[model samples]
Target chain A: MEILLSLFNGILIALEPINLGLAVIGVVVGLFVGAMPGLGSVNGVAILLPFTFVIQSFTGGATSPMIFLAAIYYGAMYGGAISSITLGIPGASTAVATTFDGRPLAMKGMAHVALVAAALASFIGGTVSNVLFTAFAPLLASVALSFGNPEIFALMLLAFATFVGLGGDDIPKTLFSICFGLVLATVGFDIISGEPRLIFFDITGFSHGIRFLVLAIGVYGIGEMIWTINTSRYGSSMSKVDVSWASMIDAMKRFQEAWRGTLIGSLLGFFVGILPAAGATPGSLMSYGVTKMLSKNPKEYGKGAIDGVAAPEAANNSASTGAMLPMMTLGIPGSPTTAVLLAGMVIWGLQPGPLLFTNQPDFVWPLIGSFYVSNLVAVLVNLAFIPVFLWMLRMPFTILAPLIFVLSLVGTYAAYMDMFDVWLMVFVGVGAFFLRILDYPVAPAVLAIVLGPIAEPKLRQSLLLSDGDFSIFFTRPIAGPITVIAIILILLPLFKVIYDKIKGKPAEA
Target chain B: MRRAEIVTAVLLGFFSVYLMWKSGEPPAWDPDVPRFANIGMIDGEGPGSGFWPFWLSAIMLVSCVWIGINWYRKKSPPSVSEEPFLDSYGKRTLFFVGMGLLGFLILIHIIGFYGGILVFMIYYMRFLGRHGWGITSLVSVSLVVFSFFFFDIAMRIVLPKGYLEPLFIPLYDMFL
Candidate 1:
């Protein structure tokens, strides 16, 4: 098939020593970022985008852009495990359940095992997903070409409903939070009108733009710092973080046991990644859940189970790959990182849509192929850094706090030259702090924000195209089935909750 | 969770009512304005382009209220009123957040965005993390300097330089 040949060509381009080097660097950085508590994937990638701008300017090639974008994502994957194993915190929502088992293992002096499993699982997921993307992306893109605006709108709605309903806490609050994000998105420019909607009386940076980085860093980074300072039991902090070759050997043994978990994770992640709203969080959560349900030693789950580590890590990586499906095919971003990638594409004068495959196979294939190289690089770097990363946690907070604080600020400022970013960070932090008190899940809020504005336009476009026929949603077979699926997703949680209550069982995690 | 839900419900209700006012009041007679052609005329005529978002938001608002009412009537124990607000964990988080906010407010004016961020990171890393001076300094300098060159100079984007303008110019020349 020409598609297959093109894909092979992409591999050739992606495997270029320079591109390969960048891919490796991305995975290495992704691991470090993923390991850090609070930095997580989204903020980690966002913080790194400034560097990408520089890369793009100097090289003026698609390779540099792909390297920057892919690296941030890979770094985020690496970052996710750090907090999970060491601090009992899943750096991102997707990895939340990882802490249940990972932290316990670390406490039991198996941090190295947890780290190794995470890395291996992530590597497997990333590599497998890249293969899947290469094999299936074109076929999927062809199918996507026929999708009308109504289908797109329905998909967005499905994503919104599923996230709002299934995300950790109270649905109403989540919707409200999402609405808040939509409001923020609408602040500067009116997409169709090209007129300012909410830009108030002239401020210095107001005319140029309001970068989302400012908001994300302010909320998650600075706000998180404040929240951490307020809540941390430094008195209750980990007593020890020891790394050993023996522990790593044990981790390898655990990985051997969790081969099924890695496979399941990668498969589920791939499927979820292909879907519009199913991102790393759901991918990780679902993989972890399925692994637990199917495990022979179910009791070991949530109690330092090695498979627990593998499932979520794999799920996260695979789902990240999955998130790219829509971006590549439909020009719709399912996740924030992908949204940033979309932004990068726009900046490069390349629009992401059905035409991407035909118009710029040169650009597209290499990026997809590079994912494989990136995943391999991630594994190598993560393995090397295992002991080093583990040991770094033992360093006293006196030295760690200031450095992270500075990195947070510098990272924020680097995204854009505005001090407004710092302020935005504080605002988000304050809001996040309060929401934490209320058990309001930030992920849904974020998901809502990211997807809301996008869906709104699609809905309108669909309506316009259909001459206001709402039936198009149900009439078009592809759109109709997807809508039905969305409906099921919305109702599934309600039914599960009600059934649990009737059965005298507590809510499912 | 219940009381918070109640408040959210009320707010949604209010927002919906507000949207009703906002949606119908878009400046009229613009040729560019789009409208839905058919919808059985919810009121007077078929809904306009803004109709779906506004009405859907309104429906959401109503649903939130219903959810709030159900929780209030059910007397859910997990409600905000039942739980201690700002638990110990919450308090600790607030302090660091305060430090960040205070630092930004004060330093951005005095040191400029780049300097303030660099200083903020160094202070946080050293004070809060208790990292070594070497790691702290190296990370702070590299991140700040590299980002400055990348975003400001190379990108031709301007950063806010309160008192650090003089320093930034020399750096800009070297990179750009």
Candidate 2:
């Protein structure tokens, strides 16, 4: 009852004119920033952090400024899906899984369904996570604290195993792709020993390593565009992007088709987000893999499954909200954006952790109140802007194609301020095109690179603690069960083969 | 398609082997530590710097060989198919697009992003796309102007201006 009263009063304070107006502006700014390649919520909030001081000086409390930043964080989660669906290039790392099915939906002229599913799922995910946050903030933060190195590595292995077990792609090719990406990620200096490794031809650029955006934009933005043009010969399926309002209305009514994915993502993403360093990316990805593994028609995934688009979209938004749990209650940032938000709190002279709620109910409730408010505004703004987004898809293939190429190049350069990366991006794009033609699944490779840097260190640290014993993964309380599951997932195909042989049906795929 | 599959496998296999060799090399600062020393655990440290990449590359090499065996047995679809890897039309399209991109990169180094963007857009719209010069000029010119304002002035990204640096000086004097 006390929680209810605090929340209700918090909602009233959040609805104040200054706070309400700031929410609108922040959401708009965040939406654009998140939808742009090489920019995400972190960049948006970091760049605009200075502006919040001005807001603070006027409002004379940290609540207004904090509300504005939180609104931007919420809005950016919605916007990340925009580029993932329409352009096939993820606007942020968090939305990477969306491209697996979202791009195919766009190609099939059902972009409305993908876009609508993404937006509605995001709204549901955000709201579900908010309720979970309001109910279990302290409990979840304590739970998050217990996740150590071995557990995190086990989770990472589970993510990769899902792709191998449930992914309908060729086995050797998928394994190869995964290995190649992991190796590529190790090109820069070794984090533990501070030793440079695999500096290809000793180019100075190799010292910084291969950046994620370089590879992502290369494969999706440039390679996919070129492949689309080659396959369609310009009169292709992508050119037939549907822009009718009827589809939009129909999409709203038919969103229930993706109910399973939405539910899985909402629940899973919130839990995953509460764990520090495991952010929205892995949450969305794990949700994608889990939804696919459980689906009766697993083949529908990566071929325009509405559930595929919905799952990741929902997960990213849900996880963004869940990420705040640790920040508010434990004084620990669950994700990079939350890290920035923590900094903002520190500057505001507010002490985070268990006492914040007791000492500063005025700040706590209003901030929680703003999460609900910002999520509502974000969905409404996204829905209203649907027509404008669809109009860009109506462009001619030749025009759109060059624009994508230019953006891929310019965005890469802008990201690291390195011309070498721009050239490497083009090279990777050409390589991706060849790999795509040969039916090599590049998605696993993309996933591997994203997780590799994080995975390697956890593995080493765990081994170190256990005196080089591999059993550390299988012996720990939390890590044991997760590790066993991952091993089962990896060996699922071999089990199938053995079963098939016993059944006298040992046929080649 | 069949032959291209084998060739690609062979090339990738070679690349993987090269990576394995490079991974085992000692850090430049401590060359006397011996090659492949970093491929496993050091005495005091956990795993060496080369542990992850060296093992991963070995797996990649094994996968490539598996691909080769599949190709030899005519098991993979690409191995069995009679279709050319890229037909005449695909070849022509690839050559033109590839050359255009190469030219754009060169132009970026020579004339910077703004000037490079202008030329590339005009070439793409007018020549490759077969649009009218009037429309191409209008669209391309408008894009350059919008980019200058958005990336340079408003965001303060300061994209290189190349030979056009002198031309933008007065504008920078006015704005920046």
Candidate 3:
């Protein structure tokens, strides 16, 4: 009853004029960003983060800016399907599984059916995850309120361990990326001792530390754009769709056949998304695989199966919302996009952990309430503006690429008002581009940069209490199991190698 | 591709070692504090500031060495692949894109963000994109104007205008 009353109040606050207006605009902007090839929610959020300050200034609160970004996240999930169904290219990685059956449906000249299914499934998926998140977030946050430094550090360790064990990237490269990001966060002055550290060449810019925004924009904005341009091989042709009312109604009727996949995706995606490393992309792909395996006509899985279209679409949307759970409750970001959001929360002068709920109900409830509003806005805008998004997609990558570069450079400068940071960001972008070519995963690094400052202090504090004894982590009941699990996760690759050797299997990567 | 993998690992290894060394430096104010003195627990002060980053960099160095070993064993994807690190088209794209970005940054130092954006857009749209003057100019000019208003005037961010500062004074006088 209490939860329902709070949710109702949150909804009312979310419906206020300014917040509602921001949601609509944010959803529209997000739709276009998500529909564009090589641009994802992360890219949209990172580039536009600086612009949110304007909204923050006017509102005198964090709720409006957060709603804007969250709406973009919701809109991007819906928009990724647009390019997948229409242009035969996944707009974002979260939409990759959509292309498997979405393109096949388009090729069968049922593009309208695929698009509607995707949009509807995404709507259902998001709604399901929102319900789950609301029910679980307060409970989890209350539980996490008891977490001490050792426990928090252990969770951080587990998060990093998941990246190494289950990230599916090269283990060493993943470790290198994580450690490098953590190290970079140590630049500028040390918070504990007030000592200057890692001030490379003693540049004045190093005094304030390398902001997370600079690294995020460089990696997602510039590096990812360069990667896309180099590797882009998408076909130019698009599937034509009838946007008439009759066709949409017919597509809606066909969407009913997708209920099973939607149900599976909504449940599985939420669970998978709650995990530290397994986010929407893997969630969607896993949902697709599971749905296909259980299908009555398994061979039709990637051959215009409506379930195939629905499963991944729903899963991605569901997973996106699910990814917010840990971020808001425990301060552990479940995905790279959520990591950026976590950083934003810190910047907005709010602590992200369990205390957030107790300390800032106004900020928390409205943001949660905005999630539901943003989902509704995203679906409606997506369905109504399909033709517009398609036309926007045809605007050519050359023009879009330059615009992104301009946004990235200008956004970095605007955020920090530092020319040196701007210069350093470009350098980082170029270096990131090189690292990307070698199959280095940049997401871990981005996540690390955000979590590092939080993790490091907790670790030092924990050790300080234990008189420099490492066993403090192992002795505490809450930290003990978590530390053990993290250790196992970190060593899983080694175990796999040993297992393979014992089984006499030939070496395989 | 195979050769690039080991070379990168070695380079990263050295970089990591340098960071570790850099992390151990004493504070400038108290130069007499021994090196690596701050990388461990103080008697009563608890863990020093350098403790975290220095250890993290050591892990990075170890990770780099592990990457080298993986490369030696041909276990990593890049190490076993026979493809060129950057094909001709890849090389050309990187060169053009990289240089274009560097040029944009260089332009910013002299002309400021708005001016830099205009030149970069024109260069990308006209020369690189092969778009005609009409659309390119229209788009570029429109963007610059929008940025100027949004960033400088309305938001009061005051982006540097470089030599173009004088020209913006009239507009600022009119707006303010």
Candidate 4:
């Protein structure tokens, strides 16, 4: 209740005309950033992060850090959806599944409607997630308090298992990629034994560990470009996606019919986001799949289904907020974006554990409050400006492609203030292209990299707590079921193949 | 699928064996180095901390082999054409990798980050795409300006100044 009141106070602070203006500007800029191919939320945020440092240098305070960071966060979220619908190019990963149907809808001359649905779904998801945050955050935080190292370890194991199972077709190859990620994580100084694993290069760059800014930008950002060039694959040309009152009415009706998907997507997103390693992409995929399964017209899916766009967009936004719960309560980052937020917390000299609520009510509550306001703002901004973004589609790729290239370089350079990072992006991008060819999925590698370092220490910590007893994984009630479920999922495909062969039935991947 | 599986199995088997052989050697350690009793059924103090990874790789190796054998020994033959593997990917691969390598080589030299991007984008968007000069020039210039403001001015993050350092000084003064 006190948290709610504090949130209210924060909302009041965020409602200031100045902050509101900043929010509008941030959302607009963020949308453009997201719409551009080769630039994404991480790049958007990272590109913007250094400016905050500059702002601090000029103004010498952390008064508006949350506002700036939140704006970028919300803006990136909004931006990612634009390209997916119109251009069939997903600017960010969370929107990959969105391209499956959103592009089809655009092709059917309903691009405006699809865009509106996605933007509105994003709003509804964000708002509902905030309400849930207001209602259940303290409760969720309290629940996390009971989780010891063993439960945490089990959770990481589940994450690893899910990455292998859900990421792609080849389980063994995915596992191999994951193992490679784990090996990469093992580089730098070991936190437990203080032993360096793979620092063969005695260079300072290898010492502090492989920065995600470097790796993500390299592998996904640069690697993707190289792969695209290698494949010589040309994107389908975009058409003018004009917003009309008729389309707006049509979108509203579709929203009415698929409101259930939005709600379910938000709920699932919130739940998945609450778990560590269960970030927006998985939440989006799960929500998308579940929505399809429950839909009356499942056949319409992957064929311009409005619910398809609504579900994943809503899921991604809701999960974005969901990711905050673990970050706020447990002091553990639930996603890379949240990890950046954690870094911000450190930058501001504010600790992020349970005590964050007590100590920095002024800082925390207002940020939470702004999330509510921002969602409303994002929807309005998107609806009113749909034509503007749609106009971007008409711009020749010749113009847009170079523009994207320049942004990519700038984004890369800004993140680390080093050309080495930019170069790294090229290397990683090229490598990623090859890996894609070999059917080695990059998402699992990323997920594994994100979860690996955290898992090792937690497992070691659990062992020490239980006096080296491995049974602690199963002896605990909360952690055991999750572990069991993960293991079952891993075996499901293999068992199904066997069962089909034995039963003289057809096989399915 | 059979051929791919066979290749994977062979690769995994070879790599796993190599890893175990290489990592199994005892490292020259200081007295302060931590040691744990090996828990494996292998002779002597069993495998060390590195042993688990080796064994896990071995299991992966075995699994790959099993899957490969199962695929190869299956009674049915593949039905459809597998022409995707035979398609021309070489030109694209070389250009893509070459472009990326060039991006690195040119960084911090004549063409800075922004300049390098401009060049890369022109070649990619114009030469590769066969785009008109008007659109390419506009996009290239706009990207550079946007990047400058976005990264340098708004974010206060510095990009590589390089040879363009002189030009950046004035812009930096204006923005900073």
On DockQ, the candidate that comes out on top is: 2
Between prediction 2 and prediction 4, the one with superior lDDT is 2
How accurate locally, in lDDT, is each candidate? 0.65, 0.87, 0.80, 0.66
Off by over 4 Å in 1: A1-118, A165-171, A174-188, A193-219, A233-239, A249-371, A398-405, A493-509, B1-60, B63-71, B77-84, B87-100, B117-159, B168-176
- Chain A (candidate 4) TM-score to true chain A: 0.72
State every prediction's TM-score relative to the real structure: 0.69, 0.97, 0.71, 0.76
Give Cα distance to truth, residue A62, candidate 1, Å. 9.9
Winner by lDDT: 2
- Candidate 2, residues A117-205: lDDT per residue as tens digits? 99999999999999999988988888878889999999899989887743364677888998998898898999899999899998998
Better of 1 and 4 by lDDT: 4
For model 3, the superposed segments whose C-alpha errors exceed 4 Å read A1-141, A165-169, A232-375, A382-390, B153-156, B170-176
Alpha-carbon RMSD of each model: 7.1, 1.6, 7.8, 5.8
Cα TM-score of candidate 1? 0.69
- Tally clashing residue pairs in candidate 4: 6
Per-residue lDDT of B1-176 in model 4, one digit per residue for the tens? 33544565577668656544433333335554333222232233222344344444555566456545545655222212243422466555566547645763476477566677677767766776778898778777776788778656765556665787887788777768
lDDT of 1 by residue, A183-213 (tens): 4444444454343333434344444444544
Residue A396 Cα positional deviation in candidate 4, in Å, after optimal superposition:
4.5
Error of 2 at A329 (Å): 2.1
TM-score, chain B, each candidate = 0.67, 0.96, 0.95, 0.64
**For residues B1-176, could you state the per-residue lDDT of candidate 1 as single tens digits?**
45565665576578666644443433334546443321123333233434544555555566567556556665333453566566656556457646654876688789876787677767666766666789888877876676576546643446577887897677666766
The DockQ-based order of candidates, best leading, equals: 2, 3, 4, 1
- For residue A159, model 1's alpha carbon misses the true position, in angstroms, by 2.5
